[model samples]
Target chain A: DAGVTQSPTHLIKTRGQQVTLRCSPKSGHDTVSWYQQALGQGPQFIFQYYEEEERQRGNFPDRFSGHQFPNYSSELNVNALLLGDSALYLCASSPVGGADEKLFFGSGTQLSVL
Target chain B: AQSVTQPDIHITVSEGASLELRCNYSYGATPYLFWYVQSPGQGLQLLLKYFSGDTLVQGIKGFEAEFKRSQSSFNLRKPSVHWSDAAEYFCAVAPDISGGYNKLIFGAGTRLAVHP
Candidate 1:
């Protein structure tokens, strides 16, 4: 079975610009969550999408948003990017009620803000 | 608030040597703990997890973690370290919230380097 997949392994954006990263959850999974891993740091939770609606969110600002489609794919959008926004954006997925404690992650999209 | 702490920023060991990485977490109730490994340019891989029942959990690739409730710590250990075992290790905790889904709180991570 295919594992979690993310698009545009790497991306570049300038300050005040916008960017969107994509994620396709593992087969048989329905929930998608996003995380941000800064240099020399572990990933921090961004938000989670289930049933096409956001269920929980972390300490991110309004500029960061996400969407989950019927197919279980997800997209994370960052508006008005700042230099601090440069980091590895990771996508993780899990089944709604099955072993929710375990999450499968994608390689992640490296976002570089200039 | 739930949080994880991996005190070691980096550790180096010789091949064939034993290894141990320390992890601690803070949570009000019983916590769901996990250990994940990440290679350069790769995603996080679950090594093992502790929900309940047993304090010592065995995981893939010769990894094992022991969760101590009194200490509020979960430490990963391996009998023998391989060169390929070198990678960044993350300790995480999942707080049980209202929703069915649990969000993970990760530590700063401990980078392991193996010398042959």
Candidate 2:
């Protein structure tokens, strides 16, 4: 089965613009989580979606939001982006909602805010 | 607050040499821990994870990590390294399912360089 997959492998946007990244969870997985990884930094949790509702969110601001579809696909939307938003945004999927569940990650969308 | 810390910013070792990467975490309860590796321009891959049962957990890529609750550590180790192992390694932690969401707290990450 295919692992978690993300769309638009790379993206470029201007400061103050908006951008959207998409993700499809791994086969047989229902929970999707989004992460942002800055240069030389580890992935930071952005939020999580389960059952078509956002179950949890990180310390990020309202400008960052996400939605999970009934099919387990997800989308991350960032508004009024800043140059600091340039980074790799990753999507991870797990089979279960438990804390001990193993996560499978997608290659990620490299967003470059100019 | 749950948090993860990887003390090493970068490490360089000769191929075939033993390697170790340090990790530390702070959580209210017994935390779930994980080690992931990311190659250049690639996404993170799970190396291994620790829950309750074993103190030592073996992972893919010939990697392993030992969980030490007393020290709040889960350091990743490999007996011998290969040049292809050059990548960035991250340590992460999460609260028990009872806490909900399974959101992860990740460290800054350690970049490993294997020199032939």
Candidate 3:
């Protein structure tokens, strides 16, 4: 009955550096999605992964990539991070077969780019 | 392209007073709508959602939302407000097409401040 969980609650990196954030989906969930929430703004969709493959993506650039493991866990990697990338990286999970099902979210990893 | 809009950037109300947050969306067809609340330094928690049926949907914390297709709006309402209700509320919509993988487009958000 565990909810979605994310690692490295906070991270700090310099421009041009890369970082990887991790997320574990909720119990009995098979789909995982990532989002970026800027200060004073809502979360923006990054991408979604299901069955170890990316199913859908948002308007983000290719620098923002993700992977889904067999256990339904997920990782978001950003290459050549820019100062604008500093934000709260959120992870959300939902069960498959239900398109409009509610999503469970993790506290999110706060990324700070210098 | 689907998008959500929360008109109110911030609102303040008495603890015992009623509350409502306005939300509008732009989409070609009916989209899955949702309302989420996020406390300071926390994640967004789903309050309620409208998928296919029932224009009026009930959610936790006595929060409810009404979906109006004509207006392309989904507004969240609560009969009374609590001090703990002070938080940021977000409105989101997701496409329901076959390729939909629960990718949601969110509004900027409405920050609620409750006074004693």
Candidate 4:
């Protein structure tokens, strides 16, 4: 009912600094996934958190990491941010591990890596 | 590996006109396709999805997408576009790996502009 919610609608960070974005999945949902959407481009998969562990990951580097809590909330951390890391970081939530899952997205955190 | 391609970057149409956005995907098996719409500074909203049944899936907002396995494409369509329909549309494919649904792979997106 509440849908997916993200914190710090926007953020600003300098190079070599780190930032953490938070996400609260929709009610009655458990799995949380993170995505990065660059300007003029679609979102690219970052990683997925299920059962408090990272279950699946995309082609992103190790600098990108995430955590899922018991309450099903998630946090995405980016270390040693680069200028290219400036993009919209989106958080999505889905239900069980079924083959057909529907993802609900949050407005996203606009990360501006200066 | 999975990927999606939206051929049109931007499309402009007058109000009350029909709309069609093209999407193509590359995957190993039957792809689970989806269409999402995003407004400025907003998250992607699911319009419709294709899992198995019908080739034509109807979504909220009067949107419909046709999944063509032969062409490896899923195109979105809407009749009588409204001004509010002007927004970014994204086509995505969910990769099935190890008996689990993986995160979606999205296209560059198509931006629609409607003139009143």
Candidate 5:
């Protein structure tokens, strides 16, 4: 089966601009989560979406938001991007009940905010 | 708050030698632990996980991890290292929350280098 897939493998945005990254979860998975991996750092949780609703969010600001579709696909939107927003945006997915412990990840979209 | 810490920022080992990467976590109750490996330009791949049961867990790779509750640590080990095993390793922990959705707290990660 195909693993989780993310769109726009790489993206470039300017400060104060907005960007949206897309993700399609692995086959037979329902929940999707987003993470940010900065240079020389591990991935940090951004938020999670389940059943077309946002279930949990991390310490991120309001500028970071996400949506889950019926097909289990997800989109991560960042508004008013800052230079620090430049990082690898990773999309992970898991089954309904095992949303936390059993996760599969996508290659991730490299966001470069200029 | 739950958190994970990987002590080594970088480690270099010769091919065919044994390898060990240290990981420590802080949590109130029993925590779920995991080890993930990431290659350049690739997503993080799950190596193994520890929820309950056996303290010694074997992963897809020639990798294994020992969970020590007493030390609050879970260290990854491999009997022999391969050049292709050179990559970044991450340790993560998840809180035993009521809801099914729990965010993972990841360590800064350890970079492994293998010398042939």
Candidate 6:
């Protein structure tokens, strides 16, 4: 069984540019959540998407957004990226049932904002 | 709001020495606790979790964690360290409420360095 998959394992961007990171949920999972891990820090929650709708979000600004497709894949879009936005974007997938605690994380996208 | 705290920013241990990473949490009730380790340029991998029933949970890599309700602590431990054990370890928690989805709040992390 395939675990969670993410695209663009590494990326480079500039300030004022936008970037979209993709994640394919683990097999048999339907919910996807995005996180940002800055250098020397832990991962911070970005938002969660279920049924293609954002169910919850973190303290991040509106510039950070995400979407979940019917296939349970997800996309995290950052608008007008800032240098501080440069971080490892992590994607975690879990089933939509009551067991949200058991999550499988994908190898994150290391985003570098130059 | 739920939060996790990993007090030790970094630690060094000998290859054959025992290891322990401290973690504490703040929550109204017993929350879902977890320990994850990450290698360089890799995503966080779940080591162990405490949902209910057992306070001591065993996980991969011979890692184990004991949840102490009174102390609000979930500390990870291992009998011996391997060179490959050198990585960043994180503690996380989520509200145990059954109705909706809860996000895992992670600590600042503790970087473990193993020496030969």
Best by DockQ: 3
Q: Cα deviation in Å at residue B40, candidate 2?
A: 1.3
Tens-place lDDT digits, model 1, residues A21-93: 9999999899999999999999999999989999899999999999999999999999999999999999999
Q: Candidate 3 at residue A112, lDDT?
A: 99
Candidate 3 residue lDDT tens string, A1-114: 778999999999999999999999988899999999999999999998989999899899999999999999999999999999999999999986764478899999999999
DockQ of 2: 0.70
Q: Write the per-residue lDDT of candidate 6 for residues A20-48, one digit (tens) a residue.
A: 99999988888888999998888998888
For model 3, the local distance difference test gives: 0.93
Fnat, 2 decimals, each candidate: 0.80, 0.73, 0.80, 0.78, 0.73, 0.53
C-alpha root-mean-square deviation, candidate 1: 1.1
lDDT of 1 at A60: 99
For chain B alone, what TM-score does every candidate structure achieve against the true structure?
Answer: 0.95, 0.94, 0.96, 0.94, 0.95, 0.94
The candidates' DockQ values read 0.77, 0.70, 0.78, 0.75, 0.72, 0.62
Residue B25, model 3: Cα distance from true site in angstroms: 0.6
**Lowest-sum lDDT 10-residue window in model 2 chain B:** B94-103
Residue B49: error of model 4 in Å? Answer: 0.3
Between candidates 1 and 4, name the one with more favorable DockQ.
1
User: Model 3, which residues run further than 4 Å from truth?
Assistant: none
How many residue pairs clash in all the candidates, one count each? 0, 0, 0, 0, 0, 0
The stretch of ten residues in a row with the least summed lDDT in candidate 2 chain A is: A95-104
Better of 1 and 3 by TM-score: 1
Tens-digit lDDT string for candidate 6 (B1-116): 67788999999999989999999999998887889999987778889888889899999999999999999999999999999999999998876455343488899999999999
Chain B of candidate 3 vs. true chain B, TM: 0.96
Q: Residue-wise lDDT of candidate 3 within B1-116, one digit each (tens)?
A: 67799999999999999999999999989888999999987888999988889899999999999999999999999999999999999999987456563788899999999999
Question: On a 0 to 100 scale, what is the lDDT of residue A73 in model 3?
Answer: 98
Interface Cα root-mean-square deviation for all models: 1.4, 1.7, 1.2, 1.5, 1.6, 1.8
Model 4 DockQ vs. reference: 0.75
Ten-residue segment with the worst summed lDDT in candidate 1 chain B?
Answer: B94-103
Q: Give every collision pair in model 1.
A: none
4 versus 5: better DockQ goes to:
4
